[model samples]
Target: MVELDSRVETRDGVALVELVVRNPTDTARRFRVGNLLDGPLWPPRSRGVPEAGWDDGGFEGVVPAEERRALGYASPLSGGARSDSLPEPPAEIVWTERAGETEAGNDASFAAEATPEGVVRSLGDHRPPADAVPTPRSGDTVSTPESGRSEPDPRRSP
Candidate 1:
């Protein structure tokens, strides 16, 4: 069986997420992990809002090819004989944020057992600087304060 774990953290307005895929089987197996974007949560409509799938943010690297073969998969990249595409398991997993938001979608599913044995980090912080202007490096552009003609105190800027 495959197991996938996802961890999310937010810092400075950015969200950091980490995904760990593990193969518990004695043999190796190939697998794919995709991020689900937007979908409805399980139980339907009671949650009052839709959820975001894995693709909504970021994803970890592809599962190793050798591992796929060990799992008896005809082709690691392909979902196998179950269908022209990979099979979709029941909606057994659900992730919710502290803000009462939920994420769900078809692509949200991943080989949990194929995930690595670590935490998943996602970064979502995008706050602008408090008062300082950004300067370009190695270019002929000069960085002046909002005054457009004078340089401001560097200490006051971020």
Candidate 2:
């Protein structure tokens, strides 16, 4: 089965409609949502061109099994006008079809199973090995190549 939730908001003389379509069944479904408002429907634009199916005052696509898809459109108000009344629900499910069915109760099997055998290490970690770290004895002076000078290692008391 399919379910739909719709909302509309007006901004700058344009009504923006958003719809969330949900497919609860184990089968994928294709659906068409038609514009229910009085104004013309304007699907979202790509590179200044309206999306496909904008002329038909509606949009259509597939919703995967057990998934929800969000769709949106815009309708420009006449003469940059504003209305005090909230627009009626801007979209309606005009039709729906079962695109395909999946194996029963197989939804959770696609996830890969993993077991952590040891501490994970990344190639970016350039730290030296534990035993390779230098530990200076108390009162020892360590020489640094950068300054060509010897300084007491701060880790141990002088």
Candidate 3:
């Protein structure tokens, strides 16, 4: 499971949020993290692969939170300029697995902050913090963590 924390702070003239993600699994998995409303949001890719579920217009990089925002990217939960029509920011962590896909079990909100190192420390993973968000997976559809969802057969194709 992925643990994410979202909180708000200010940058430039906009209110932004920071999302911290932690990979509890022992094996390093390719993942994508992003704001649902802003099309594709930021650390665009990890371990090389596209880290599923990310939309277009997403940038790729691994840096601290402060540097991400300084580059003018919206916070993961900012929702850009269409907040009224979009659902609350559905920031998530996603990865590809035989089960088709999997998403972090929670839908958390976030705001911007300056503590990039703190965010990285909070993530508890070795990956550098950056502005890129992740993609979503089919695992997101299952509401329970212990639901025992079956993994897709690797031999099969979508």
**Residue-level error in angstroms, candidate 2, position 14:** 0.9
RMSD of each: 17.9, 16.9, 19.7
Clashes of 2: 0
> lDDT tens string, model 3, 13-126?
343545665545543333455554453344333344233233454322232222221122344444444434444444544442211123223212122222443344334456
Cα lDDT of model 2 overall? Answer: 0.68
Taking all chains together, each candidate's TM-score versus the true structure is 0.27, 0.56, 0.31
lDDT of 1 by residue, 6-76 (tens): 55443333323344555455433334444332221121111232122222222222233213211110112
Candidate 2 accuracy as TM-score: 0.56
lDDT of 1 at 103: 19
lDDT of every model, 2 decimals? 0.31, 0.68, 0.39
In candidate 1, position 78 carries an lDDT of: 19
After superposition, candidate 1 runs with Cα above 4 Å error: 37-158
Worst 10 residues of 1 by lDDT: 69-78
Off by over 4 Å in 2: 52-54, 79-87, 100-158
Per-residue lDDT tens digits of candidate 2, residues 59-145? Answer: 766788899988898877776356555456668889999774542321212132121211111112344555676667666887887
lDDT of 2 at 80: 38
